[model samples]
Target: MRNASDLPPEAAEASASGVERRARWLLVLLAGLLVASAAYLLYARGVFEPTQTLVLVADDAEGVSVGMDLTFSGFPIGRVRRIELGGDGYARILVDVARRDAHWLRESSVFTMERGLVGGTRLRAYTGVLEGPLLPDGAQRQVLRGDALADLPRMVNAARELLEQLKAMTDPDAPLNASLREVRQLLQKANGRDGVLGVLMGNEADRTRVTAALDDVRRLLQRLQGVADRADALVQRTDQRVFGAQGLADDVQASAREARDLLVGLRATLQRVDGVLAEVHGIAVNTRSATQDLDALRVEVEATLRRVDGMILDIQRRWPFSRDAEVKLP
Candidate 1:
């Protein structure tokens, strides 16, 4: 456990050299760790991965800068690599999208650069259809710029114009004011005389119209009362005629009884007539059977001829008329 001062100069020098070597090794290790950390950070940021280039043209690049992220659904899919002035005088923004994340972008994808009043600008991508065709490498596309405070001046101008219009409408000499004054006058009249009825009939000169209408209503009520009284009397008379002891109902019942008796008599008479008709039909049949004497009938017909000849002779004697039916000519 001797002190280093008691050691030989060679051994002391060798110990010093070994200490120096160790210190140098520690410093080199620290440098290597720093470099490794830096490389890991770059790799996490996707610096080492191969990327596709996209060109975005815009009228303005107010808040856009290099190294800004182009995000889709809040995920960093691409980055703004550079911004340059194009030959057409527009700002041409260059974006670098990594190969893995670039699949989210399609041919129909839309890009926007939005600047807000409260925050820095954001570059965003929107893909309408994930199944659409892929965006080609080095595709030149347009970036739509949107500003949250862009329409503020126009809106203020519109508000000022509307205020002027409202002021004009409220002016003393405006027709709208005249109409409002007339309405106020009408509201005042609504509280007077016949109340709102007078207002409905019209102004001061037409106040009597409401009074006349009231009089007509009174007359109509009186007439209706008279009509009701008359109708009540008529109903009483009708009740007496229909239901009283000496009423038309009693007379109708008596007539109905007489008619029933007459109908019974008529039916009995028709029965008797029907019996007589039956007897006549029987007699006709008997007579037809008894008159089956054809030879006797011919003999009677001869006898009738002789009688008729005698009658003719008597008629000739009595009348002194011509028996000859022949005519003589000169």
Candidate 2:
């Protein structure tokens, strides 16, 4: 290798110049890379994105810090940018919400800070009505704090009360124990000679009375069955007498036929009587001129009247009931 001292001065100067130029170019490239990386980091952090401010007031901000996310539906929508104690002794949390994600919040949005038993504090936002008016920028709202540890004392008290109730239940003099004793006595009674009846009737005397009553009911039912059988026989005999051959129904039919024949004969007799009455009326109208024919007409009327009397007597004989009948000449 040739030493630099043995080279010409211009060549050495040119070599030095080339190395400087390369070093300058490398520095320039590194500077450009640094600027690009910074720009990418700023973009990723959303430093240039348009945002709205939301102020949440809380009584305490023990676990909340700047850079904490305000989540909506388990997704981060805003970031806490500042926390300050207000003059009214409240902790005010200022959040920067991206303009795009701010639409997820509404006037009805509720913000909460929750500190769980096994995890870090979480900030959450809930919007119930999507159609509500949008939350304006720089709107100050109250934040609700939910701490699992805060309910420890109340839960402990409730657990103590439950344990006390269990202790009282196990005591010998407790109502539950007394009830159990009564149940045991009832079970013993149910297994005794009277069985379940003894338990229901509450005493041996009452059980005996109930048993006697049940036996009486059974005997009465048997008597009623015997009575029902006798009634059925009686109904059979009545049916035979009322509707059998040569029974009351047959006699009634015969009487009805005879009565019908009598009615026909009586109708014919009434027609003959009507003719006689007409002849009499004619005689009465011309009594002077018809004096000789009057005796003949009277004889004819007497014959018709005799026939009517015979028909009435025949009707009275055929009928089931009889009445005194007499024919008189008018």
Candidate 3:
């Protein structure tokens, strides 16, 4: 190894070429890496890709920032590149959505800015139907916000009202307390000897009166059962006297049967009398044909007497005359 200053200026430069060339090569590699890193960053930011623009208008831009991701279905599809005030004093967010992901957005898609309790603001897209018409480039849409912090005042107010209602209900002077006291009294009454009836009657006197009335009703029902039993026994005795084998009803039935037989005999005698009457009528005609004098009349009278005697005989044959039979004196 020679001294670095031994050669000429140009030669001296060449003599230390190993370390110098290595350092130069290292710097070139570092520069290439830096350029590659910059290209990668630009690609990631979608600066070099073809993109469609969408403008979102909102009332407030509290948590929105440039370079925020616009997510669709939990995947990033666009980036918010600018935020500014519009001519109408509304916030405008200009977003750059890649061409490939632009198809995911629809004309009916809803855009929103939401800030959670812990995270930064997020831009979101909701496409209810993927089959709808595609969202046009450079379209302006309204942004809806559902910021957790923004809703805090309303939530606090609702919570405060609820607490007030709860406190009012728990207060000693509230109607709920009165109802509870009434329920407690009712429960105590229900636990008494009268049970649920005591609670319904509300006082001891009324409950006692109701219990006495129940006892009276029970006694009345028992008396009615005894009366029914006595009535049943009387009916049995009457049945034995009127309808048993050697009872009054049997004698009455025998009398009725004899009376029916007498009536039948009387009806048969009446039929014989009618037949005799027809014969007498024929005899009266014969007498009128024979003579209109007393002789022929005497013959007709004899024939009529014979027919009447036959009728009498038939009556006797049907039913013999009793000893109490009477002959009327004409």
Best candidate according to lDDT = 2
Query: Candidate 3's error at 319, in angstroms?
Result: 20
The candidate that wins on TM-score is 3
Q: lDDT of model 2 at residue 32? A: 100
1-330 per-residue lDDT for model 3 (tens digits): 777777689887776787889999999999999999999999877899999999999999888888899999899999988999989999999999999999999999999999899989999999999999999999999999998897899999999999999999999999999999999988887887779998888788998999999999999999999999999999999899999988989999999999999999999999999999999999988888566587878999999999987777666666656564433325
Q: Distance (Å) between predicted and true CA of 73, model 3?
A: 0.6
Query: Please, what are the lDDT tens digits per residue for candidate 1 over residues 6-109?
Result: 99999999999999999999999999999999999999988999999999999998788899999999999998999999999999999999999889999999
Ten contiguous residues with the weakest lDDT in model 1: 321-330
Number of the candidate with higher TM-score, 1 or 3: 3
User: What's model 3's TM-score?
Assistant: 0.62
Could you report the Cα RMSD, in angstroms, for every candidate shown? 13.7, 10.6, 11.4
17 Cα displacement, candidate 2 (Å): 9.2
Model 3 scores a C-alpha lDDT of 0.91
lDDT score, candidate 1 = 0.91
The sequence of per-residue lDDT tens digits that candidate 2 reaches over residues 22-140 is 99999999999999999999988888999999999999999998899999999999999999999999999999999999999999999999998898999999999999999999999
